[model samples]
Target: MSKFSFPFFFIVLLVGSSCKEERQNDTAENFTEFVNPFIGTGGHGHTFPGATAPFGMVQPSPDNGTTGWDWCSGYHITDSIISGFGQLHLSGTGIGDLADLLLMPTGKTLDVSLFGTTRDSLPYTSRFSHSSEIASPGYYKVNLESNNIQVELTANEYVSFHKYTYQNTNEPSFVIDLGYAVNWDTPTESSITLESETQIVGYRHSTGWAKNQKVFFVVETSEPIVSSQFMANSETLDSKNEAKGIKTGGQFFFDQDSTKTVEIKIAVSSVSIANAKENLISRGNSISFDEVKSQTNNKWEALLSKIKIETPQDSLKTIFYTALYHTQIAPVLFSDVNGEFRLQNDSIDSTQDWNAYSTLSLWDTFRAENPLLNILQPERANDIVQSMLAYYDEQGRLPVWTLYGNETNTMTGNHGVSVITDTYLKGIRGYNVDKAYEAVRNTMMGDIRGLAPYKKYGYIPYTELDESVTISLEFAYNDWCVAQIAKDLGKEEDYKYFSNRSKAYKYLFDTDTGFMRGKSGDGKSWNEPFDPKFSSHREHTDYTEGNAWQHSWFVLHDVPGFIELHGGNQTFTKKLEQLFTESSEISGENVSADISGLIGQYAHGNEPSHHIAYMFNSAKEPWKTQYWVRQILDTQYTQQPEGLSGNEDCGQMSAWYVFSSLGLYPMNPASAQYEFGSPLFEKATIAISDTKNFTIIAENTSPINKYIQAVKLNGESLQRTYITHTELMTGGTLEFEMGPDPNKNWGI
Candidate 1:
């Protein structure tokens, strides 16, 4: 037995025995049972069903192959093959990257000649069936039919635990492929060193969505490695212990044992291999696989238990909790246990006072996910803002899309400004507010992503940039967020400047077509030959992942002005009604696949139209808001593998479901107000804070009774269609009397 194996096994036995009795007596609810990690994996949802703690650094998930759009998360439900299990993965992203440090267990040794030195080539592959697969909040298990090996995976914040049970196999080997890459990811450099018989350390530096991604890892196995072959660039190296090149890997043969079980623990760090080793020693060295699984289960239970719902159907409960589970999967922990992390400038920062986070998909998340985080996970939200501020301090701009420690500068607008403004306005001031404001201001003032032309033309013109209308509208909303922060900081002049800038969306609104059309740089006329339903995928279009009908409602911060732009409340509501009742057909040679969950032209699958359903509240047509909110809640989300209507987009889609299912949504996410919607549950108790509990009760709620007839907050009748964030945080009961028919006069 290896020296590390005996102590680890002894500790496992001791801890398991000691905790058995206590665990039997404990009757805490297991919220993980309600979460189906596979709910979004089948469709364009792009979710991976794997082992990961809430915002965990290590995601030890199976990768199918490094090809195509469905393989964004490294695995798709449609694929039955497994290339290997990777340490890192992106959940529900449109673009793909980061399936680093892949390891595959096989019954036979791999032929190095059969593998090619590219992201697409697989050293070892296996077929797996869904019937033999099981996934929960922090655990994933699959039986590989090709190798007849049962693979079980679990993870904590920093380490991933893998246990492989060989079935009737003579040869049991592991192929640790450092060269493995998927989708947009390409390994720039990689290396592996066998530190000892049972220990291996390596690093994979890659480029893709995250321009400069670095992942350093330490691997420890329970069984002793009897023989090893190191390979680089598809060639076996003369050196037995180490290989260094752009493409590198190692195949290790473990000693045949009667136990037939091999356990592996992998710890990752963004800083260095030393930090990775330290992380494993501190976090994973002594813990058993079952113990780690139990710990991660408890952690997820605690977070998921924060919001408890009593629904009529078990499936609804599953769907609701699954959505909640998806919301906590990103902006994952970036700082190591010792407060060491890689800064944006390719330097290490060891002085971080708090946990740093990455995977900030600001364009999608700023709409709902960040707002939901401010309420549910305020402490982490503060850390996220701090991380963004750190990025700004190093790179002189807030992150557009950050993964690991690299900024991708993806998507559009200064939505990071919106996330910071929302976090600060929500009173989660754990971060430096002044520095945050400076980041927001500096980011907005920068001449990038069409900002220069936007400043000159008031709105981005089609002549100056593609996706002009979409960029202008999103920037306007972000400008409104900046205005709010400036106003709160008592910078009146700056506030006035940004507040005016916030109205830039009006420049693109063409009264002739009643749509926000792209304008020419001359500002004399709108871009000609426009169609509201025309959309182009990643082309020179005025919209991004959406058409005019969707981008026109991007003015979430100034709904009143937007309503006036349509002439009046009646006209506005009519146009708003048309958005959901018009033709759902989109016309283009290459229409964006993101325009899914179509209720007419209101694409619920995407972010731009997320708040559109609640716009009727401002128009005094509260019943319409309630009706459409319920419609979306019922149809857009489900419990099956292809459940989600679109890409979860790092939790924005799920966050929308979470808030809307609770009968409220952030129409303007930074506004600190939640507009009323149709609640899906009979009753939901939200542990708003450690001490405060906010409960929502829907009396006589059923499938038919989807509309609110009356409303009450704590025993008094509520007249407004919206509630303030302060009201919710203070903790009270918000009751809704539901009926088959809408009470048009209720909130109005």
Candidate 2:
């Protein structure tokens, strides 16, 4: 057997043996059952329990009858009815869009007005209970109470498979609502065309977080349509080749036996309608819904098997696996089956052999999700880097909150630098580093979005830019990543330039207040009337969706520098202590709802404070890091539908949980180093490679005995407070002795 493959097999076998028999079974049965997709569907989790393959373009899930904050992903547990199953969705995001090509099937006698322009007006929308609903990795099923129809959804890479079983109707009708949009999204234009009796094609252009977004789809049904009608803005038109308007809808009446199921495949593409059809034809011709579901389940099992923790606590396992599931939901496959994708300005791109990807919440993912991918899915990580480079090649800069081939530029910082640099430093080679470096250097040196003033002055001036302090701090971290890439590429001058620029964050650090605050144009004085606890909800604020207490510790590249600026470890650690123990209250006119899941002022729900708990390691207070990390892990995450304390932010929040639960975190993602924290699990094994396994074993590990007494790597005493990625990938056992009290001397 290959060397790396043995360890993965060992982990699988060992986990199988150690876990309880009821929860331990075949690879697919045990692990798949533990996944609770509904955990984040309720509350503000904004996650969809949809049927989607790993990084697939199609997210076929039920949209609830609402356009509220919790329904960002189109589905919320609190909602009373399912509007329809859309072929697209967003998981754990603040803004909601892409609930495109919504398909609702019911009995032929149902009124068309019952399915209205908005979900709230749809009286025919079916009610579904959690007891009858089922969701796994790439599958979702629900029984609609409106017409007593059972809906089952599954997906491949680019197409969604939907099976509808009507209980008493011999003739079933389906409505395609191309105009349907939810939360912070609006469909500018939409089109639906009847290609044949059994086939249909359409497109929807939208404006939202992704401006100028376009999605083309080709849907094919098992049974031929006996009759069809087109409707636009409440006006019904005779069947035609095409129907185009702002509010376009299509109704297809199908001939099917009452007992037999009617299945349909919807293929989606950002490229073109023909490409969408080609995608469906290429992959959907021979595959059955069950086969597609099985394939998707196996895909998740293989990915989840990369890290196997030997624990009897099913709740922890459920949370870990669900978090792992969230990480694969984005950086989706943009390229179609023929390796074609839409480029900037609605053009076609067919440059590479590897598939292109998008939906990069880089501002969030660069912290932990991307780094986690570098460990668990290095191949995909390399592809994602290439995709970013490809985006740079087209758009002349890396994407911010990009989706559907559009650079949304929604968030701050050119964080694609961090993602690229982190992967490069980990030795994940595939993409062109010189070109990558060019993109990174250009992004840092670009004259757009206050970078000119940021370069002219030491930092971005509050008078010139919004979120000046946060931008400067985030850009400093981005610059540090650029510096690392430059140094590795042997560009001494570039390294020197970015290295100097990386320290520009020091200019915004208010020495008197001990918080990073916005500075004036002269850089001699801070912005006036600064309340560190106050977060201005306006766009023209010093912070972005965060207060000073949260963004103050964002200097991921230089925690030591941050400590020095805060008057040494004693004062620095005390500030961190206060950040945790302080009141969970904010003083502001309009505070950001993104700042939830609060522990004192440490908002675990947002990305800004993600690394703060681990920052205690650098402050020489490892126990505090252990205490807070454990506290957040236990309190912020749960097995319920509203278990998440904050937005999933794609997978950043969940990724943090996965890493912290395992006693490791990527404090500085650009560096290969991972700061150590208290491990929540008793024994965990990571299949690093085919020939190696990195095992983490915590003895006497429990709720009370959460403190680490001692640590040994490969039976050798470990003195460092952090571990490197190289050391982890090389494979060895890291054993931790646990106790109720912290060993204070450990790692010191």
Candidate 3:
């Protein structure tokens, strides 16, 4: 195992080895101490040195650097200091948001600013030597020297793990206060209600990406403190302190000196106070911390096991599995036990097992990950589609950026339509197809359509509002996917409508310039100089977070058409090669690290380029695909903080790596076809489904023979990059003869 495996396996094994009964399955052995949340607990990583339930929506951790960034997800590798942990962390957010409602333990008067302290002026923050931090996939732990508090934090779906150790000495006390705000907007009203001698519940009205959200939490401790403090503008806090009425923050400390350890349990709700109370009742605090962590790990294992790829190379296997792991982290469950959930319309609704999962950046996932989900996690894909459908039913439109039940509409394009359209075409069963169709249509053609910009202006025109070029290219592709979905359902008019709509990119396609250019509403004049490179589309130029090199190949539904548009195969290949080997001139925009792996302007880090590498298959030049795909796998990704080089983009990046490493890529998800590539392992098999009990295998593969000599499905030769979902689900073996170098005309 590589050095990465130690920490990686430790987290997995700790969670997997939940109890003694399952000791037999604990095959992967390792030696490691408890975790250190303080490790990646700061800087660009956005990780908090706190406990969380695995993949659970509620992440309670300490807030040191509440300033938002991706590293803030849990902890960043860049930060060197130790701060307290808050309960909520938003993973990999480009715009630092949602490290809200911080709870820290301190003895001094409560102060919120972090400016007074410097790296040297305050050594307590850095007193945490790196040797003392323990971090795994599911757990973290560290000790605070300033206060002599040893902290251990982990997760167990919807529950957090916290173990605070107060060393045997004086100042044996702790504090829990709710006055801190985590990117919290001013609440219209705030109130703290006592539930019992040992419990407190309250509501904090705040707004940000998840606007109009009313946060309610129930906190119960293993032991009760002798006293509690409230600061609502000076209302008698204690003999020396008083509740300051309408004060911004308040805190209370534990009075006992003999107590050495303590644990806290909390539950949050977005619906109502009653629902928050119910959320607590559902989890009656009897389960051990180990048990919860173990349970959460098992849940992850079961989910991950749906698609099992067995390869001899541990790194390849680990990377593949880890990529698969990262892919499933989002579209998180946002419902309560009663099937009640917040709707996109912002109304709390009651349903029967119908829940909403948000943070689905489907514009990226539709390339490969969703297709993977349809086959391995069809049930989950169905639920996701159902949730989108439910979003339509409630919000009267499909979602863009959803938090719990709220939709932020952050990004461009309406991909919920394409996802639904593709799901229906793939023959998956989960939601009402008719309702799904209605949603697909409403989102594709909504009066205030997110996609309307593309249709009206031939391409999305960068007006005072909107990402013109990017929205155009993306909408064109999504609209094309919708056209396919429309065709399948025999909605002739809708098919023709979207089919016509899908070609809107052609208007911006400068036949003379041979690039998709941004145009104004007048449609004759193109955006000046039209350089796709160094253009930060985020400023509403033409593209979205990309330059010409990245957006040029956005059309995936019709590669042949795109190649023809580019004036044939040879020129197309030349342009693509330049895209990969060219340099990127940095523009000072928040160009998502997702746009990493710059070859000229071709960024392997983002989604637009995901299919560009595979599009070579369309020209029957499979050798190029093999070369670039292998190169991308080897160099662009690693097993460390800088490892990703881009946003996981809701598993889209991971899914791309997973799919490509398997020697197959999903060019189009709803089509049930995968573009074949060179497999990166000796042997890889997909256990089809439970009822079918079938499997697909790739044999005689290795790093040397990374080029596919030939592929046989079941027992026959294949012509194209695609294989049916049914053929895969029914089970079969895909044998291959890989070689060190390309066979000049091998896959050709």
Candidate 4:
């Protein structure tokens, strides 16, 4: 028997007997302790280090001021000065917006004029050290050196709680900034009113990616407010009615002394102030700070327990759980306690049966994040599809990249179709299938964006629109998703039509260059002066965020057809090899920051090339896929602040990590099959449902054991390159014996 395995039972130990004592001592660490909230706060990770429950709408995190771009989440690890804690924030996104309801603690005697209402100056900001900061899964703490104050933050589903400790100060004040907008955000109107002496209720209307975004909040404090003042653009406002401006906030002085602590709770809603107050009273109050923290941690533990792994490496556990944590940050719960949520039409939805959820980020998430959720969180998956259907009911079409009851129309393709179809095919049937089908077909059949041109010409023409090539390719994949649903629904005619439309990727294939290139509107010839490696900074280009090399293999729905187009597997394998062995340099005049984390021409940082490594399965080179998958897992992710390679893109980047680290990749995200790669852990137990748990064990596994030697499913010999979602849900053990060298005959 291998050192990592037990003889009688199928329990997974370590690789050696010497590590038994080490494992015994490490049993006290909860899964939450392995989560480092700061992993993606630095560099281009674009993740927020905040206190939030799983999929909670409230995110209370310190903002270090923003210069746009890297400050998408309103927080950066490089900045030492924290202006305030924003109740709402973005996670791992390319654009920034929600930094709503900024609250900052200040010394009562501090000069207000020096700071002003804006965070552009001193009094509103304070420098803090990382040494005094503590961040776990659902809690965050930091000390401001300038004010001798300590701030701790925690959250429930819709409400956020703040605890402030003052030392050597008799007077303490909390600044409530209602109109403080972050990057790409402009506040049009805002209002704040002192309801009694201990409560404030208001709303802020802004224009940004979501266009007409409205956020209402109800803030209540444990202490009484002795005095209050309102300001707009740093000037004191005498108007008690409403304050309207780009910069508006309030200052409330509390009756407190030295070494005193005050607690505050804020509940927010997109519907109305009444719902916000209801949310606050129902979910936030009647819970102590420690109880809130404890309950939040318990919620995180319950969520993390869905996928349990036994490993001796602390680094592996940290990275795995952190990646999993990132996957649950978005697709936020948008419904209130009464199932009340705002719709895209600026009206309230009072539906009691279906709950609404926003933050789809469909362009990025349709790749893997939503697919992972289909497996781990099937019920939430159903709710997410229902939420998209709700948007479809509100608007004429499905959401491209939605948030807070608005469609940003960012990125490309009818990708929501991919998410819906993938979720439905995974055997999750909690949504209305007819409505989903209608929404899916409407995205393709509607004459919106470039879909009309794609249908008319079999592909979008470059002269007709920019990014015509990638848009056509993505639309083709989405059409494939629609076709799958059509086939499942017994609509044979629709299935045939959509299936034919799904092959539109072939029109852009420049047979001479073996790359998917752009063609003019007339379809007589390809676009002139085509540089396959060239991409724009952020504007119109032949591709979305990548060049032709990365976009070539994006046809994940038809890798076999792609291989056939290249003659056979031999030529296809050679071309696939070139994607990782070609020139490593990118030569565009103004390249995008998203086109990073490069391994040769294959960019892992962005979503385009995510499934490229796993395509080796179709080329009869699964070992190469294993080698590169392990390489990307080790080199691309880390336990540090700047651990990620690029924008976590909501959670797609981390979803790729979570799926690939477990020795599987959903090559076709809309399909139920998972392509095998190299498993990083010795054992992983997945709780598929309430009554079943699936376990995957790797025997004789180590750092050098990157290839599979043999495999067994529940002690029966297994010989397949893919596993079905149904098989995984049946509750069984999949064991693989690992060796230092490739046993190519095992799965092939």
How would you encode candidate 3's per-residue C-alpha lDDT over 1-748 as one tens digit per residue?
A: 1223234544543553343222212235221111222322222333343444434657655444433355436346555555456566655444444544444444443432231132233212324544456554455666676666777666655555566776753434344333433343333445565556466667665566677665666666676655554545323344323222232234444545656677766667767667766776676368665666566556655665655555544445455665766666566666766667776455776656555566666666777767777777777788788878777877787776666577777676777877776677778857787787777777767646445555556566655345667777777777777778678778898888878877876777777767777777777887776555655546656667677778877776777887888888887887777777876776645554446666667777677778888878888788888888888888765544455556666567778888888777877665677777777755555656655543445565665667776777778986556677777777777766677777666556
lDDT of 4 by residue, 650-687 (tens): 89999999988887888898888888888988888898
Alpha-carbon RMSD to native, per candidate: 6.4, 5.0, 5.3, 5.1
Model 4 lDDT at residue 133: 78
Ten-residue stretch with the least lDDT total in model 4: 1-10
What do the candidate models score in CA lDDT, each in turn?
0.87, 0.83, 0.62, 0.83
Ranking of all candidate structures by their lDDT, best first: 1, 2, 4, 3
* Model 1, runs deviating above 4 Å: 1-29, 116-123, 257-259
Query: Which residue pairs come into collision in candidate 1?
Result: none
Q: Give the TM-score (vs. native) of candidate 4.
A: 0.95
Candidate 2 stretches with Cα past 4 Å from truth are 1-29, 109-116, 256-259
Enumerate clash totals for all models, in the order shown: 0, 5, 55, 1
Off by over 4 Å in 3: 1-55, 66-74, 106-127, 169-189, 232-249, 344-346, 447-453, 462-466, 587-594, 691-700
Query: What's the TM-score of each model vs. the native?
Result: 0.95, 0.95, 0.87, 0.95
Q: Which parts of model 4 are misplaced by more than 4 Å?
A: 1-28, 109-118, 239-246
Q: Which is better, 1 or 3, measured by lDDT?
A: 1
* Candidate 1: 10-residue stretch with minimal lDDT: 1-10
Model 1 gets an lDDT of 0.87
Specify the highest-lDDT model's number. Answer: 1
